[model samples]
Target: MYIPDIYKNENQEEIQNFIHENSFAILVNQTDGKLWATHIPLILDKNEAGKDILVGHVSKENPQAGSFSENAEVLAIFSGPHTYVSSSWYDHENVPTWNYLAAHIYGKVKVLNHDEAVGSLKKLVDKYEKKSKTPLRVEDLSKKTMMQACGIIAFEIEITSVEAVKKLSQNRDKKNYDNIISELENIGDLNSKQMADEMRKNK
Candidate 1:
């Protein structure tokens, strides 16, 4: 991820929160000299010592997972709010651009078997669904459902590196940033509102 200083997000906690908030991410790897990508929901596990680990699964039919080579690097892209910005929204004449937030996590790939996969499923459910809500009991699932889900392969990626970019009009002057926020607020798109809110927080 190429991030300018103004748009760089260096806070580890903030980056993890962003990934958790937008858990569905694009897993990218190389296969036979070709780049392969699969969209899946991933969870970041924070151990008691505060170490972060990546957990997720892909369908057995999805050949993307088969492409991972030992020591090969994989990238998971977690995308947040994004929207186009019109030059007209700026106080002065400027080229139009897009504002967005994204995180790129690089890790070493390791496939997990049935037992580990089951544990991964449990962790996923626990992370996303609130503990207070009635959780979906995997053991209670029918054999058909269990077999069907178990067929999907699961893996853990030990994140060796990570980067995040928060390009929410950070390069713009305060006046222009404020103008952009005002314009975004009136557009009524949820993404625009999110961008506006991000800009406001940075201000």
Candidate 2:
């Protein structure tokens, strides 16, 4: 991801928070000279020592999972709320831009074995089930069944590097930023208004 110096987010805590809040991410990998992508929810794990890792799995039939070997550079993009910013809202003549928050993480991935894959499944289950009224539960799949139904790929990214961007109107004057906020707030769509609210948070 191309991030300008002004828009760069170097705060590790903030970046991790963004990833947690927007766990659904686009997983990108290089295949046979082509880029392959898949959208999936990922869990961020942090140890007591503050070391961080990422965990996720794709469907068994999804070809993207097979592209990564024991050590492959992979990127996962987690996007937060964003909206279009019209140039008309700026104080001076400026190009139209987008306001948003995102994090891109690059790391090496290793395919997990069957036993390790089972733990990954449980983590996914716990995440989705935590909010259910009945708390739907999944019993561990048999080794044979898990090996069959699950493409059963689990990989951990050591987070070799991360880049985050927060493209709000930080470069603009207060008046122009306020005007943009008011305009966004007046938008009828809920998401637009939500984006506006988010923008206002940093002001």
Local distance difference test, each candidate: 0.85, 0.81
TM-score of each: 0.90, 0.88
For residues 1-203, could you state the per-residue lDDT of candidate 2 as single tens digits? 89889889998888888888899999898877788898988899853467788888877677777678722889999998889889998768989988888999998786777677767777877887888887644464455655553555777777888999988888888899899899988885765787788778878
**Pick by TM-score: which candidate is best?**
1
* Candidate no. 1 TM-score: 0.90
Model 1 has an lDDT value of 0.85
Give the 10-residue window scoring lowest on summed lDDT in candidate 2. 136-145
Once fitted onto the true fold, the runs of candidate 1 whose alpha carbons sit more than 4 angstroms away are 47-50, 69-71, 131-134
Rate residue 99 of model 1 by lDDT.
91
The positional error of residue 196 in candidate 1, measured at the CA in angstroms, is 1.0
Give lDDT: candidate 2, residue 93.
90
